[model samples]
Target: MSTKYQLFIEECQELLAELESALLELEIEPGNIDGVHRVFRSLHTIKGSAAMLGLEDVRELTNDLESLFDRVRSREIACNPKLVTLSFRYKDMLTEYLQDPEKGLPQDKTTQILMDLEQVLDAPVHAASRPVESACEDCGSCRPENDKDADILLRLYHLRYHPANKSFDSLDPMDFLSQMQQLGPCEIHASPELVPPLDSLEPSRCVTSWDVILQTGADEETIRDVFLFLDDPGDVSQFREINVDEAAKLRQAQAAQLSGLLAATNRPVAPLPADEDDDLELPEPTESSSAPSSSQPGSPAAVSSIRAPSSPAPPQAASQEASEAEPRKAPPAGGVKAEEIASIRVSATKLDDMVDLVGQLVIVQARLKQIESELHNPLLTSVSEEIERLSGDLRERTLSLRMLPIGSTFNRFRRLVRDLSSELNKEIELKTNGAETELDKTVIEKLSDPLVHILRNSIDHGVESAEIRRAQGKPAKGTITLSAMQSAGQVRIVIKDDGGGIDPDKIFAKAVERGLARADSRPPDRDVLQLIFAPGFSTAEKVTAVSGRGVGMDVVKRSLESLKGTVEIDSRPGQGTTINIGLPLTLAIIEGLLVTLGEEYYVIPLSDVLECVEIQRGDDEPERIAKAYDVRGELLPCLVLRNWYHMGSTGPEIEQVVVVQAGNRRVGLVVDSIVGQLQTVIKGLGRVFNGMRGLSGATIMGNGALALILDVASLVTELEQREVAGTGRNKRSDRSH
Candidate 1:
């Protein structure tokens, strides 16, 4: 595909996302004029862009939707649930078609949406459903003098259109003019002044300008919508509403000009008075015009725009009238200027390549530093240090390019929650917080599935139904808040729901029945809760479409572990449940604590390390490899790396215990020595070693030696399990005695 076509697809997909969001907002707040206008503008731009790209299917479909919202804008057709649902279906279908335009549109879905739209447009909107326009009339200062005046009033508009870029690649100005004609009786006049002589004229280039006089009841903003797809309409088009006196003057002036031109050309044709056409009054549009434009104007010779008055036109007022009308528009801080924001769309593959290149540079820099130290050459050391600084900066910058706000991922769950809530016959509101928290783009992409599973579980099991909630003295509507934040170089995401929390007894009983827990032993609540993450473990008595096959939570656990992240849950029986997840800011490079165990070296993520302390080794064999050590005053769980890896020799007289935080507990890793902290570029072990326990991945050291990166969370979990099994054995032995 051509770059232009790809870009068009990307742009339309983004617009469709915004369209869905607007439609959702409209569903909630039917009177939200801002949302209605937003829906209209998104559709308008998509349709115009599609037409320019020769995507008639998209253009036609979007145009129909745009007309529906246009009426919603005019308050002719009230924004209703039926309209919102139909718009969503259309948005979804358009999204699919854009992704694979060669397949053409799905006729069954398209026809259904169009048929539903027709039904909605033809349905009568009761007075109660329409927004109350006279609410302000009771206020003394707001009442209009003419209380019985017609709601829709005809206005005369003058418009000038000149193509900013004469190239045919951009949108055709004639297409916009045709749209203007549909509003009412419009006279179009084409000026051929810029048209060159036939001998010199380029057939592919357009130089003609158009003048249009449109008499329509549509507001100035509505007219501006015709040219909405232009990158910058103000540069090529001008709109000025003419008052009654100005219209009369313009008509007389235009008639004289036409007469003079006709006589000078020696055409011998009588010039009709402009007012003569006024006899053909343009009838007002019906309550709504939901049909797409049937055809494009073949010629621009008939176009005419109202002439400007002697005074300068108020272009700012005319362009900003729509915004001004929305009294409760979102504040500047809350609104994003998507079009104005300077940004470029880049592919994930390119970013991945850049990250890979940066990672190589870091490895090369490390090797250089190792040589510098070994040779102890002053010049070599200086050069190595400089290269190190530059490489470090480059690495940081490249990794940041992969960082994206998690909000987009968060917004996606809104649709999921909405559909599920309706399916389950519940009323649930999904709220988001700290969406601006940024993480590696790779992390965010992988993060979506886990988040979806968690959210589904929350809606299915965490949040209670409306009847259950009300009986429990809670509001009928349940709320689930998904939030994220950054702290100490780690992104923390929390999925919290205000619903009935998990029951420890039920979880433990299910675990025993599933053979995942001991039937004779009662574990702590925390351990019982951990059973939820076990493979094929579920507490649901019966399977349902949403969940209950015991698949989602385990996937969530494995996915997080693969990302070197952790998840923990906290619950209050009747209050709610909150699941907390911790993830690294970037996965490309991380600060790691390098430690040597016997002949091998390993790197521990610095983010998890709390402190390092020196401990003397004991000569007693059992004491030397004790599972617990006293750090300061507290007895922390300890793992002896040398013994765990089954190294042949243990020669160290003094060992360093690196205390690292794993989930909720702290564990000390005993190693031969501390090799200091360094930026570790993580390298994945190939498929041969995929899912290797006790190791997340590996990194390269300064000496070009491989250092396996410790999966502290996994190791800690293993240690805890061992302790639990040992305790169980001791208890059983005591009962036998």
Candidate 2:
């Protein structure tokens, strides 16, 4: 794909994520104005960008969604469950159209959504049952007249024109008037009643009005069309049709007076002056001007007598003469204002690539620091320290570029909960908090599916049925809450439900039935509940395919683990369940505790490492150091690296025990020597090692060496399993005794 197209895709994905999160929030607090505004803004932005790229279908669909939001924001419609559900469908449709504009708009689903939206919007307004009428009192016409077979005619009328100061530019009044002339003959009479003196004219301010006489055989529709494009609908006033006989009489009198005046002038005949009065006044044609011979020389006396003694030249005529003698003013300094021009669209992919390159540079800088430490040269160390500081700053800024508020992803779930709850015949309220917590763009993208699955599970299984909830003295509606916060070095996202909690016994029985555990297995309540995340583990008596197949939670767990994250489950038999997922702030660079086993080096994530201690190894050493201490009384089981990985050398005389914690368990990993702390650049293991155990992945070290990054959680789990199996065998032996 072209860079721009790629960027569009990335931006669209981000917007979609944001839209989902906002929707979820709206599900809980349907009247949340901020949530509604956020979703509206995303849709508006997407629509604008798509229109810029000529993606008409995407633009049109988003425009409709935006209009729906406008109604909600205006309080014209209450946010009902139906509206929220429709919004989710709208989001999905917009996403589909963004992906493939040629697919030609959303299918019938979009129409249905829009119909539902209209119904919601029209509900209150329709209940009032009031007839809609034109705001103008004199104009009885409800709609504009057609232009076909229209004749341009001119009749005198008192008119008032007020250009909306906020809408139309001062220099552009003539353009609008010119458009008006297209509909009919427009005779403009300048009314100087409101005109201030030239010194205080305020050229930018409108200082005059036009008493216009427009004659058109076209109906009122054509006349209104002339002003339809104007920003202020109420400005064009005193509009009505006049009789043709009256118009003809006025024209005849004007012609006769002009002829008499021309006869009186010794010089060439000047143009007839326009009236300055706000009201229309047409002089009566009398017996004195019955003949057309007033143009002759002998009629000078008659012409002079007909002219009013004290009347001065009309303002229009003087203004025209003055305009010929003066030049127009220049525009203000600084080229055209920025707001007058349109905005440009850029792809977000280019920005992402820039961030990635910056991350790599940070790693390289870390390596240089290592080299500087070994060199011990004063000058080199000084330069390295400066570079290190710069790199650190750059890394922070680069990572920030990829950080987006969790709110973006939270908006989308509103629609999901709205729709899913209705489909399942349940009432679910979704609440969200800490949506402003920022996380990596990639993390946000991967989080959507898992969040959706969790939410679906909560609605379908965790939340009690509406009937059951009501019978149990609970509110008819159930609530699902999604919250996020930054803790330690990771972003913690929790999805909690106030519904019927998971049954530990059911989970334990299901695990044994699936052969995932022994029939007689007795584990802690938490451990038994965690079994719901195991593959194909389900307690639902029947599956309807929405969420009950029991394959979703496990997938959610695995997907989170792939992002170097962990999921924790908390539940009570009669209360509710909360699933907390902890994800690293950024996946690019991480602090690691470097250690060695034989000739190979491995980096353990520092976040998980509790502490490190030196263990003296000798023939007299205990067979197991389950009681190893690290300044605390806590006993941590130690795993010898050389023995675990089968390194080809004798054990170290003094092995270092790296105490690492994953979830609630802490274990000590024994290594030959400590390699000191190093900045590790994570690299994915190839497809061959995709399913590898114990190792999370690989990272490049400062010395250009490949170091395995230990998956602390996996390793700790494996060790615990081995220990448990050994204890079980020992118990069997005791039974024999």
Candidate 3:
């Protein structure tokens, strides 16, 4: 596809999103001028871009819709609930159209929407376009009636039209003429004489200009408004008011001179008008015509417009593009504000490439620093340190580029909730907070499916019927709140619903029946709630279209785990359930606590660590699998790493314990020593290591060795699944493998 077409597709999608958002807002505040403007702008942009790309079907559809918005914006037609509903349908249709780039919009749907919009607008839909009309009334008056007492002066403004660098293959000549009429009725003449032959012509270049005569009573300022958007950097100076007689004389002299040259060269001159063919009614030729006897006496051989063989005549397609303005460049504010506001759209592929390059640079910088430190030379040390600082800054900025607000992901669920509510016959409202919280784009994409399943579960199973809610002394409407917040080095997302909550007794019974729990087992609330995450586990009474066809919560858990994230569930039987998901701010890089275990390096995510403490010799190493550590008078179970992974190294006389939190549980990790904190880019281990119990990912270190990134949650869960001898009768947790 052409680059312009690709841009159109991307831009169309963005416009569709904006259109949906605006329509939804209109549903809330029908008279919001800003929302109406937003909808209008989005529709207008889609129409112009579709036209430019020759997507006629889409152009026609948007043109009809744009016509309707114009009426709504002018308050001629009210924007009501029916319109909002139809607008959503329109969004859905455009989405389908853009999905397949080869095909335009569906023929049937496009026709139907056009017919419907045209009927509502009380107007006819044209496949091509209409002429622009003067904004002022068509009384043929030169000035406003309110200025009757003032001296009425007719100012002739000479305006010229030129095309941009983009192709103007479909531009109409008379279209811009109508737009110019808004100032007042004006006579337009086209000059295409400068156009080259078809074989030599550059398609993007314009070889045409229009000679316009304005008969407006309005001042130069009002006349200038008609051409404001059409003016480019240098074009503005070409537009100014000329006296009517001088303009007419200028035209006559030029025409006479041209006709004489054409007659002398034995070339046929284009016919001038005996009468104006247009509605503008051009005036009869002045006395100068009688003096020009260059040709036969009765010949009407005065040139109106010279056109190339390949170009369409000016009248057939008026300059349709003058009304289509290029995007505006906002004026710079204070230097700081300008810097803060400037931004450009970059493709995901480009950003990913930058990230990869930056990662390589970081590794190379670390290697250089290592070599410099070994050399122990003052000059080399200074240079290495400076390069290291620059690389660190570049890495931080690169990673920050991957961080995007969660709001865009959150916006998608609005449509899902609306449709689900309708299908389930429930009065449910989705409330969101902290949507501006940022997370990695990769994480957001991975979260989409899981989020969808979670929301489906909430609507289909979490919320109760309206009658049940009222009976329970709650409001008739159920609310599901989706929120996000940034804490530490993690983004926390909470999906909570105010509905019938899970019952621990029922969950325990179900788990036992499914062979997931022992028949004699009596688990606590948290353990019972976790049974929902077991594969193929669901509490829905019977299968329905919405959910409970047997695939859900477990998938959510797996998806989060793949991102090295964790999910936890909290519920109160009569209240509601809230599922909390914790994810790293960015998967590209992280702040880690690097430690050495048996001469091997390991990195633990810094977000999980609460504090570090030293342990003495003798009884420091746990005699059994689970050991209890007293930290500030609170006893926490400590998981010994060297023995579990079989590192095959003797325990040091003194060891360090890093207290970390995984979900709601706090535990300690035993390592030989803590080597402080450093930021590292995580690289995934291949499939061979995927099945291993407690490691998440791996990263390269300054010493040209690989360090394993710890999966704190998985480690905690593994410890929970094992029954131990030492840590106060450690009971194996009921967590799934």
Candidate 4:
């Protein structure tokens, strides 16, 4: 695709995100004018840009939707539930078409949807006979003499015109005046009061000027167009529109008989006219009244006097009164005040390029740090320290630029719940919290599908039917809560539902029936729950369109592990189910405990390591050949890395065990020796090692050494599987494998 088209797609995606947020807000408040206006503005902007790019289909569809929202804003029609639902449908269809324009649309379906929209527009409005007026009475004046001969009055002050030297060659003042005359007759007068002498005046400069009287039937817009071409050359210093109605009312109020008659009827009279030469005088009315009567012109009344007395007041008046009553207070000290947000259009490719550059910078910084550590001069050491501090700050700021709130990712589920609930004929309420928690942009993008699958599973199978819930003494509507929080150095996201929880017995039976486990196998509750993460294991009685496809949770687990994260489940048979996901704050850099097994080096994430213990030959042994350690009365299994990876040779008699904890499980990884701590830059294990079961990823150390980062959770599971198979005790099997 062309760069312009790519940029258009990115801009459209941002608009869709904004539209989704506004729609969700509308769903909650329904009468939020700001939210409605926001959605309307986004749609209008997208439609205009799409048209400019020759995306006719997108432009047309969005234009139609924008018009619908415009009517809602004008209060010509109320927003009903049905209209809101249709708006969501329209948003979805537009999003899909924009993402894949080549997917041909069905003409019949498109026609039906448009026809349905027209029916909404045809619905009766409350005040269909009245036409809305756009002119502001406060800024302009109007005169209505018997309502048939109406004239507008205007004022002008210091109106100067400048003509470009080139423009004067092709155009004359007479031609411009002729255009103005078409609107109204112009009576010109010249003032040579400030004119310089002929010799001082350059022929290139405009010396001629005019004062004119204009009388026309055209509106203000047409009158302004006459001077449009003159804007660049010079300025029209001042212009004003006058109201003839107010002038006539002032004349009538000055007549003594009118004032006396109005006073007797308890009606306020209009203001008397001031002398034309008295520019500083204010209009003085006969009485103080808030509004002017239609019979009187030139009344000193509110600017809104032109509005019908029965009509609703302008919404701005209420806002103005509110502001007057309680001025906006200042924010508290040390707080980040809210500022107006501006939306900018950017191409996705640009963002991708930026991320790639940042990644390369991280690698370069790592290399620099290695070089700095080896420098010996004191002056050089100080300079290196300063550089390191600055580089660290830069890296942090750049990474933060790519972090976005999870709220945007969470909002999509609102529509998902709405649609799925209607289809299943069930009542479900989705509650969310900690939506403001931010994560890596890439992680957030990849989280959407997995979250959708998890939510769908909760709604379709985790929650019981409304009738069943009520019978069980629970609320008729099922509730699902999605929440997130940052603890330690990781983000924890929990998806919990107040419905039927997972049954261990059923999972166990399924595992045995599918030959995933032996019938005689007996495991703890936690172990059985972990089975859900195994490939092809599911407890659904039958497959459905929504879920039960048996390809969801396992994939979710794998994806999380690939990011150096872990997923766990906790459930009580009659209570509820909660899925807990713990993810690292960043994937680029990490503090690790570096160690060596024979000749190879590896890193264990500092966050996971509890401590390191030295294991003697016969000090503590729990089983034959397999190493185990007792730390604070807890027995932890230790994996011998030299045997696991088949290292060539061993040198040290003493072995080191790195104790690591993930969730509630603790395991010790035995290595040849501990090599202290180092800051490492994470690198991916390429396709060649993509299927490696126990390694999460690889990284580069300071001394130009390649270190493998172990997947702790996966290694622990592998150990358990081997132990269950009764082959874990065989030393020969471990060495060959």
How high is each candidate's TM-score? 0.78, 0.65, 0.75, 0.69
Q: Residues 1-737, candidate 2, lDDT per residue (tens digit)?
A: 44445556677787787887787778778867789877877776676556544566666767877887776765566667677767777767767765765566756876777677667666663222222444542231222345211212223221345553333342356644654554345555455456556687676777665545554333443344444334444566445333323233323333334444455554444444443232233233334333332132221111111221123344355444434322233212211234653654434587677766876876788688779878898998999889888877877787787788989788778777877888999988888899899998888988898889889888888898889998988898999999999876778899999898888888888888889888765777877777888888888888886866889998898888888788889988668898988888877777889888888889998888877888777564333422344436766676665655644467777878898877667788888888788766677788888767777778776667789988877677666765655531111111110
Output the worst ten-in-a-row residue range by lDDT, candidate 3: 318-327
- What is the alpha-carbon lDDT for the whole of candidate 1? 0.74
To one decimal, what is the Cα RMSD in angstroms of model 1 from the true structure?
A: 9.3
Find the 10 residues in a row with the least total lDDT in model 2: 728-737
lDDT of 4 by residue, 1-737 (tens): 65546656666777787887788778777667778777887786576556545566766777787888777776677666666777777777767776766563456656766887898888777474223554643232332334321223332111223333334554466645555543443333343334457679666656655444343444443444445434232334333332223322222222333344446669975553333232221122223223332233333222221111222223355334323322135322211123622454454467656656655555566566677667766776776667667766766776676778888888789878877977888888889999999988778877877788788888887888889888999888888899999976678899999888999889888888878777887687778888887788777778888767678878888778767778888999768899998887777666788888766888888888888987664433223334566766888777766656655454356778888877667888887788887665667888978778678788766556778887777777767766666554434443231
Q: Write the per-residue lDDT of candidate 3 for residues 1-737, one digit (tens) a residue.
A: 75656677787788898898888778778878679878987886676556545567777777778778877765667777767777787889988877776876777876777666666776433323222345543222433546432233344455555443334564444444655664555666555556667798887666666666555555544444333223232332244444433344435534544555466669966755544443232223334333332222322212222222222223212222222111123223210124554686799999999998988877787788779878899998998889888998998898889888899888889888888987888988889899899888899989898899999999988898888898999999899999999887788999999988889889888888888888665766887788898998877788888877557888998999998888899999879989999988888878899998887889999999999998764454444446676878998787777766765556787878999998889998888888878677789889877677688888898778999898999988777765321142223333212
Ranking by lDDT: 1, 3, 2, 4
Best by TM-score: 1
Q: Rate the local accuracy (lDDT) of all candidates.
A: 0.74, 0.66, 0.71, 0.64
Tell me which of candidates 1 and 4 scores higher on TM-score: 1
How many residue pairs in model 4 have overlapping backbones? 11
Model 3 score (lDDT): 0.71
After the best TM-score superposition of candidate 1, give how far the Cα of residue 131 lies from its true spot, in angstroms: 8.1
The residue-by-residue lDDT of candidate 1 on 1-737, one tens digit each, is 76557777887788888888888788789888779878987887677667755678777878888888877776777888888878878877877787777787898897888788788889675565454567543232233445322234455666667773377765567666767776777766675546666799876777777766677765555565455455445533445554333343444444444444556678654545445444324223232211111111111111133433333223344324423322243322212234544776689899999999988888899899889888999999999999999998998899889998999898888889998999999999999999888899989989998999999999999999999999999999999999899876688999999999999999998898888888898878988888899889887879999988999999999999888899999888999999999998888899899988877889999999999998887666633333677778999878776766656586588879999887678888888999898889999888978746788889888787999998888778766876676621111111110
